[model samples]
Target: MSAIEVLAPGLLTTVQDLGREGFGPMGVSPSGAADPLALRMGNRLVGNAEGAATLEMTLLGGTFLFREGGIGALTGSDFGANLDGTAVPRWASFEVKPGQTLRLGPTRSGARCYLCVQGGIAVKSFLGSASTHLLSGLGGHEGRALRKGDVLKIGDAREAKEKGTDHNASSTEGAHKSNRLRSVAAKALELLAPRKVLRVTPGPQSDWFPKAAQRIFYSSTYRVSEEANRMGLRLAGPAIREGAHGEMISEGVSLGAIQVAAGGLPILLFVEQQTTGGYAKMANVISADFSSLGQLRPRDEIRFELVNFESARKLFIEQEKLLAAKDLIV
Candidate 1:
């Protein structure tokens, strides 16, 4: 099988699938797509499974050379995508021929870009997934970012056909680099707009915070610090005042758990967060918008809206059904 050739490696591009399942008990984070919806949609565009192994490109993804003909769909962050020197429409299905080079330069909108090819990337897994958990050093191409000269064997190129409509694959403005994903309406909007609000529900330890902290939590706009990454997002804002029990015995912390440290700063846990955390959890981001939380940039402002668990679950299921697994591209 002819694999993708890493000609100019992006800042940090790695092979990731849906993520590792059933391993959180052992403290393995499901380190897969930063924007899972985009990943899954892209996979569907290429007639791949929802959790097929794809490339997770960072803020500035590098270039690659596809040696054979296949359907390639790019989602998540639009890092100035170009399908062989011409502008590649995003949010819509596009095709790449063998020997063509796909370029993803710096991003103009979100933080990560997910590239899904036909079929899926053929990489061995450590724990039933192709996602790479860098902290635990599991999955992906040796659990690290891709470098020049690395070759990734892909699944059958011919069978990797796109499954959806490419409705939003047209060009948009301010696309020096863009992340124009296919909206429900199939519009190609630029991703450089204002950072979006991230809704959340009060945490298991939300009561640990004082009244002052709770009030500030919902009202104030918090900025994501540069210290943020796949594991957690460190925010800069008014320190979240906590109760006397600064640190509790470690307990399971689900994805999107927001823990406030001793100094009062809040951190939103992501796919790579530890199974257990001692810091007081100020809030829990709903799974529905977990991918949006992963897209925050440095200095991006995000406000939280409180929702009940039942409401959150409903929103999650509704969102899941919004886009079907079939014919994701136009």
Candidate 2:
């Protein structure tokens, strides 16, 4: 069987998919790709399902040896990758021959990068997902970050190739597919352009914060603290002075829920965030900005923009429509 042999596991490389949903009631948060859009695009580029498992490299990237050859693609932040000493472009598909080494370095654009293969990574599923839940250590390859010398099995892509979905079918066909994919990728990039300001809507506990605190949250610039991770990001900015409402009961929290604890600093929940939180959530990031949250790096400066539910819904619909386009890939 075809497989990937890790030569050097980069910082926090892991197998991840779209994540396990509907398990929040069982204390499991949807631990999936940080940049879900990138993962989906990368998978589509390689003729795999959008939720196919792929390697997620954080900050730094890894080196791997492909056995029996394969097709792959890189997405998200550019990590300066090279295959057998030849530089490879991001957001496009490439072929790897037997014994070829693919190496990647530190990120050049954002916090994370994804390496998606045509067949996807073959890992045991937990709760119907191959995503690695870092905090809980339950899914993926042994449920943790990859290590050097680990061998990752690649799934079968014959079905896709037989159906003429593989873009690298022939030299002539490949050139045409490449041009088409480049155009689509360019559009996707524009749609996911980096933004320092994240849009959000009021949370259930938005009233807990006074108008002044709400104003501060909306206007002030906050830096992502060093304490940021998949679980959440702690912001270092002006302390939000919330109205004194006695400690309330803990409730369920969702991705991008900004919780303000005793110190008044906001903790922006992420993919691996807890199922529930007790701190008062002053705001909730709109769904359209979820991919923006994934690209954030330590000490990165960010701001918040307030929008109504209707506006947020519209933004989400527009993004989904673009992602769901039939011409997203060749």
**Best candidate per lDDT, number?**
2
Cα lDDT tens digits for candidate 1, 234-316: 99997776552667888989999988888787888988888888888888999888878767777888888889989999877
Model 1: lDDT of residue 155: 79
lDDT of 1 at 139: 84
Over 1-330, each residue of candidate 2 has an lDDT whose tens digit, in order, gives: 799999999998999888888987789998899988888778777766677789999999999999888888999998999999999988888889999999999999889899998778989889988899998888999999999999999987643233321222222222243223332446667877757799999988999788898888888999999888999999999988675243568899989999888888899999999999788888999998998888999999999999999999999989877777665554
Off by over 4 Å in 2: 158-183, 244-246
Error of 2 at 160 (Å): 7.6
Question: Which segments of model 1 are wrong by more than 4 Å?
Answer: 157-195, 325-328
- What TM-score quantifies how close candidate 2 is to the native fold? 0.92
TM-score of each: 0.88, 0.92
| Local distance difference test scores for all models | 0.74, 0.84
